[model samples]
Target chain A: QQQVKQSPQSLIVQKGGISIINCAYENTAFDYFPWYQQFPGKGPALLIAIRPDVSEKKEGRFTISFNKSAKQFSLHIMDSQPGDSATYFCAARPTDSWGKLQFGAGTQVVVTP
Target chain B: DAMVIQNPRYQVTQFGKPVTLSCSQTLNHNVMYWYQQKSSQAPKLLFHYYDKDFNNEADTPDNFQSRRPNTSFCFLDIRSPGLGDAAMYLCATSSPLGTSGYTFGSGTRLTVV
Candidate 1:
């Protein structure tokens, strides 16, 4: 079973626009939600993350809005730039399982100038 | 900077050939994980080691095996490569002490010819 589902297999946004990606999960055990950005031929790097305790967390232009009761979370990139164009993935880890992370399918984002 | 390192950024192996991929960490984290990511797909966990204790995913193929002799190093041994095995292998490390998430290596792209 796919524990996490992500929408919009691909996205295109103008430079300086807000690029948003969403993810939903069915596992209530998941307490940690993290977003990762991956360029071609590279590994996924942690972009932003949020715990169930917070409704929103922002760092720089990247923000993660998490809703525990709804079992949903989203990543928002403010003023998305060409540099932000890459594949993004959402992952969740259960508090009981420290090392196991369940990942979403992924979204390919492109920023056009 | 302290980080996860995967060797042989690109590897090509013939069908039925045995191959091994290596990973090392400078972060000295307690947990190490191996993930297989196919093109445009989410990364799937194959196995992990929490300080020498190997944990394999229930669905992972038997042809895949992993070993961690020490904290600094881990190895993934594919007893026999198949065409379908071609993918990017990522190694990641994390400290159980905090919820900061994992540090991932650049990844090794494996091509089974």
Candidate 2:
């Protein structure tokens, strides 16, 4: 079963617009949430991450809004650029799992110029 | 500057042939992971090694095996390549301390003909 769920399999946005992707999990033991960006023929890179203790975490143009109670989280890319186009994945890791990550279905974001 | 490196970024093998993919990390992280990613899908964990202890996911097929000779090197061996096994194989490393998130190598794209 998919431990984490993500919406909008694919999304297209205009340059300078905002791109938002959402993910949710049912496992309460999950304590770590992370987002990864993958370009064509490349590895997935860690974009941003947030722990349950914080409701939101922002890194430059990337922001992660986490809702513990809702068991949901979302990634917002500010000022989407053409180069930002890639597949984004949301993942959750339970405490004491030895860094085993459960990933959600990825979202393909395309920023058009 | 490449922390994690996967050799033979692309591989083509005949059906039923055995193939091995390699991963090496310069970071010397204690935890190493292997993930299988199909097109437009989330990465599925195949197995991992913490130092020298191998942990296999329950659902991972027996046809897939892994070996970690030391802290810096890990290999994924596919006993028999099938058309269904054609996908991207990703290698990632993380510290057992769990201070930093995973660092992934550019995945190996496997094609079984």
Candidates 1 onward: DockQ, in order: 0.80, 0.83
TM-score of chain B of each: 0.97, 0.97
Worst 10 residues of 1 chain B by lDDT: B93-102
Per-residue lDDT of candidate 2, residues B1-113 (tens digit)? 75999988999999999999999999989999999999988888999898999999999999999999888899999999899999999999998776667999999999999
Q: What is the per-residue lDDT of model 2 for residues A31-100, given as tens digits with 9 covering 90 to 100?
A: 7898999998899999999989999999999999999889999999999999999999999988868598
Compared with the true structure, model 1 gives a TM-score of 0.97
The model with the greatest DockQ is: 2
lDDT values for all models: 0.92, 0.93
Local accuracy of candidate 1 as per-residue lDDT tens digits, B1-113: 99899999999999999999999999989999999999999999999888878898999999999999999999999999999999999999988753778899999999999
Q: Candidate 1: which pairs clash? A: none
